[model samples]
Target: MEINGVEIKDTYAEGFGIKVTRILVTAATEELAKIAATEATGYGTSVIGCPAEAGIDCFVPAEHTPDGRPGYAIMICQGGKKALDHELMERIGMCVLTAPTTAAFNLLESEDTLKTGNKLKFFGDGFEKECFIDGRKVHSIPIMSGDFLVESEFGYKDGVAGGNFFILAKDQMTGVKAAQAAVEAISKIESVITPFPGGMVASGSKVGSNKYSKFLNASTNEKMCVTLKDEVESDIRADADGVFEIVIDGVDEESVRSAMKSGIEAACAVDGVLEISAGNFDGKLGAYIINLHELF
Candidate 1:
């Protein structure tokens, strides 16, 4: 199948079931809110080596925010409950608490709970105070700057991760441009995040290492390597000189599919993009299989 003359590979992107939490970081302005959200979600791309995968969902205007300020929503994901909890605690404590004029709140609205401010409040050394805002418990912890307002609990729920697709181009520059366009498109979608640096991955990986090493859990995806076209059973085309990937984690299958569709369409609209493909583990990796064909 082809979308806008860009070939859609006859394959599916494998996904995984993971625990997710949505956090809202609000600030006096959108800029500060973005800084806090970006910081909190930094270094969180793949769960392979990182503790979690996170990305900015979108911007929330002052009228929509809890504190009547600009805010940014981000989703943090981990393999399990404990891991997700740990990620939230570390990220919120270090990132949000340190940002100027910023406050954190729960955005998921799920019954399942994760301790966010409740854990970070201790940073106040018993001087922390509590209050109720619109029926939700919020804590104000004193800091060197003043006080940091944080929601007591963060919402937690099961989410889908590892939703990804590859952009094959005739050259590296073209591939990068296409990937950027795709990322921009996906960023507009809600309840999902690209996670990776600049929302693009130049070094994609496969399931396991070819040379089994104690330090390496996964190795490079040789099939997507243009240089290895003649070296291994490559999936790269003869004319393809570059390959970049965009991986997404969403609150649900629908959100993932929606983002993927927008990304693929945007990528296909770019010039020099030869084809669009996805990474899958023969349907063994996870229960969700986002078929690229079905998307179009």
Candidate 2:
């Protein structure tokens, strides 16, 4: 398939199942809310080495927030319930709770609930008080500035992870530019996280190693490397000089598909972008496979 004269390869992106939760961080102003949200999501790009994958979903105006203050919606993705709970406690306690005039609230309306500030209320040293805001249970913890408000529980749901695509270009600079455009486009999307540094992954990996240890978790995709085109079994064209990938984790298949489609469209509109493709470990690695050709 061709989009704006850019070739779309007949490949699919592999995605696995994960757990996702949404947290709303509110403050006196939008700037403060964003500061807390950005700090909470720091160092949370990919699960490869990070504890959790997270990103800012969007900014919520004061009217839409629980505390009648500006807020930001953030999503955190993890492998299981225990991991998600641990990550949320650590992130919110250290980041959002410490920020000035900041408060955290659970945005999910599901019947299922996970302990959020319920565990952190101990910092109040037996002085914490239970309160109700808009009929929702909230814990007011005493702090230096004033009372720190946090929700007792948060909501979580099953999600699809590891939705990825590749951008092959004529040169490294060209590939980087395409990836930047793709990231910018996907950043506006809701319920999805790119899970990589600046929303781009230069070290695309395959399942295992061709040599060395058999127990290796992952190895480089030499076939897609422009420098190793002649030495390895390559999928890169003779004119292609570099390739970069974008991996997305979303609440569902539809969200992931929408993110991928928008990202691909933005990347294809750039010059020197040769082809758009995706990464997949056959049909065995993930729960869902998003086909690139069918995205448009």
Candidate 3:
């Protein structure tokens, strides 16, 4: 298929099931809220090495927040309940809870939950208090800056992960422009996030290394690399000089499909985009085999 003169490869992106937690990080100022969110999501681009896959879903206005403060919607994704439990403690306690004038709230309505706040209230050294915020039960912990607020329980549910697409262009600048366009479009989407840095992966890698499988968990996609075009069985066209991959994780398969369609269309509108493609492990690696053609 051709979209805006750019070729769309008939392929699929492989993705597996995961647990997802959506949290509201609110603060006195928008900047502080964003800072806390960013910190909580740092080193969380991919699950291959990071403890979780996370990113800022969108910005919420003060009036829309539960505490009447500006905040950002952040999503943390893990392989299962156990890993998610550890991530929430580290990210929320060390990142959001430590930020100045910031408060964390669970946004998911899932019945399954974790007593994240109840676990962290120990930081108060036996002086923590139970409270209600806008009808939701919460815990107030005393901190050096002020009282830190966190919902008593945070909900989590099964989600989708590793849905991705590749953007091929004539040069790095063109590739970056196209990728940025895609990220901007995907940002408006709810219940989905592009976890890579700036929502774009410049150095996309495969599941494992061909030469040193035991030494590394992942290796560069040589076929997709511009520099190795001649040495390897290249995937890009002769004229294609740059390639970027965008990975989307969402609350469900439908949400991921919507994000892929929107992001691909937005990227195709940019000049010099050559083709759009996706990564897959022959349906051997993931629970979902999302076909690119099926998206449209």
Candidate 4:
């Protein structure tokens, strides 16, 4: 199939079930809130190496925020519950708590809970106190910047991760432009986050290593490598010179599917976009299969 003259490859993105939690970081101003959110989500592009996969989900207005201040909603995802809990304490304690005029709150409601604030409140020693913000229970931990409030019990739920698509272009510059357009379009969708830098991955990886099988879990995707096109069995179109992969994580499978479709359409609208494909391990690595052709 084709979209705007761009070929839609008959492949699917392999996605797996994971744990997800959304936190709201509010501050005196929008800029401050963004800083806290950015810091908390930093170095969280992929779960392969990073302890967590996180990104800013959306911005919340003052009226909607618990402290009547502007805030950014961020999602932190992990492959398991313990990892998510550990990452929540580390990120929120080190990043959000350190930020000026910032407070963290739970943005999602789920039956499963993580004692995030309970663990971090110890930073206050004996001075920590239980408090309520906007009718929600929280921990008021005194800090040099007055007090840092964090939700007592952060809610967590199962989420979908690794939903991705690749944009094949005539050159690196064109691939970047198309990927940027796709990321911008995906940003409009709610309950989804693209954790990569600028929401695109230039170095796509395949499962396992050809040589260092014990030390390396993955290696460069040679099929997407223009230089290795002739040497390796290439997946890129004959005219394509570069490829960019955009990976998406969402609250559920439907949101991931929607983001993939939206990103694909946006990429196809860009000039020199040769094809849209996806990464997968023959549907063995994940529970969800997001077919690129089915998206259209």
- Top model number, lDDT: 3
Residues 34-68, candidate 4, lDDT per residue (tens digit)? 99999999999988888889999889999998899
| lDDT of prediction 3 | 0.95
Candidate 1 lDDT by residue in tens digits, 1-296: 99888899999999989998988999988999999999999989898888889989999899987789999999999999998898998899999999999999999988899877888889999999999876779999999888999999998888999999999999999999999999999989989999999999999998888788666889998889888999999899899998999999999999999999999999999989999999998987899989999997
Candidate 3: tens digits of C-alpha lDDT, residues 254-294: 99999999999999999999999999888878989999998
What TM-score would each prediction reach against the true structure?
0.97, 0.95, 0.98, 0.98
| Cα distance off (Å), candidate 2, residue 296 | 1.8
lDDT of 2 at 185: 96
Candidate 2 lDDT over 180-240, as tens digits, reads 9999999888888787778899999887788855677678888988889999989898888
- Lowest lDDT 10-residue stretch of candidate 4: 287-296
Clashes (N, CA, C under 3 Å) per candidate = 0, 0, 0, 0
